[model samples]
Target: MNKLLAGKRLLITGAARGLGLDFAQAACAAGAQVVMADILDELVEQEAGALVEQGFDAVAVRLDLADPESIKAVAAFSAARFGEVDGLVNCGAIATGIGGPDMCELEIDTWDRVMTVNVRGTWLMSRAMVPHLAASTAGKIVNIASDTALWGAPRLMAYVASKGAVISMSRSMARELGAQNICVNTVCPGLTLVEATAYVPRERHEHYINGRAIQREQMPEDVTGSVLYLLSDLASFVTGQTLAVNGGFVCN
Candidate 1:
């Protein structure tokens, strides 16, 4: 079969492990040259090197979503490595660990940290990559969000709110970048099982599985097809949409 992303150059943040790692692997498998970036420098380098050994065009860079300079550095590195970036997947985000406190009890610093990395980081990364994306024949941007943002899950106000902002930001970006022939969209996944979510309570896990139309635990692989589609030429005209990859949970 023809690779869906052949000749495409894509960048993914938070790619050291979990969903971000899954995205990198999937993109490479689809024949895209991938830049896998994360705050975990050593781990990301190892992961990217593994991909290269497997005969894929992949590279790793350190990216701290909380720092603007880090975002700019990664953007420059990606452009220099790939010549031009065809797509960007903003998968780097902070989720509530062990579960979050209610909004009234949440610390100001915690809230700010979540917002800074999840919302601001996403915006800044996109800002830095727009010119490069526009240079491609079919530029694409896919922002990773959460189904909880749509359903208003309790005790995780900071995470939910941040992802909500991402959804809104993606739409506005889509409109602004449309003239440049760039497509921007958001993909909201359910409570997926990954290292980042291992701290979540088992009850909550069961709750999600029971609520989903598929009646199974969602995994990183489950979310990749939608992302791949959004980044492919097939989605050239599809923009400003929020696709829920939660097995019918909180359908939108």
Candidate 2:
């Protein structure tokens, strides 16, 4: 609501629900024009419409991160809808039903799917948006990662590996994009209560609750401030860093 992102245009993926939706709403409240995308086209449209009803500059687009061309199309569509994107939040990922399998038990097909959507998708999305970001003075990219990779959480091999790849890839991207003045960073959230996390084991949630320094359930909004700050000029000089917004569940 501070209007810090008043004139900025942003695109967020996996925005049909959960953290991605939270990011879109927060960015819109801060006066940003947002393009919310997801594989769930109807649900995403509904969410975006709710924002529009609130007088926010927002629209929904269908995006299948698993498809390379779909990723490129969304980037172009975003620019056409608003303008050259000033910020991008890679929040779309495959988390549901991905856990409970050890790495040895994790099927190769499932591993490939997770990589396609989470790792490659993040990379391809950033690549597709580089041109638009280069045109902006304060372009920013915030990739959503998970703390599971930090503490080596078990029974979620594919998800953890994909997130670890994101963190590593983000560092390299920051160095590469620095020449264009575009900051690329990662945000690692702990087990949070969200649509995607509905399938998480209750014991896992309890573990996070008891282990976190804050000793409470983490919410989607808990991580928004970090994402917003990374998108804002306040973090213009900050890049290639991973901020764990997990209330000390996994301290870096």
Report the number of the highest-lDDT candidate: 1
**Backbone clashes in model 2:** 0
The runs of at least 3 residues in candidate 1 whose Cα sits more than 4 Å from the true structure, single-residue gaps closed, are none
Give the lowest summed-lDDT range of ten residues in model 1: 94-103
lDDT per residue (tens digit) for residues 106-165 in model 1: 999999999999999999999999999988867999999999999999999999999999
Score each candidate by Cα lDDT: 0.94, 0.92
TM-scores across all candidates?
0.98, 0.98
> In model 2, where is the ten-residue run with the lowest total lDDT?
95-104
Candidate 2 lDDT by residue in tens digits, 90-130: 99999636347786788899889999999999999999999
Which TM-score value belongs to model 2? 0.98
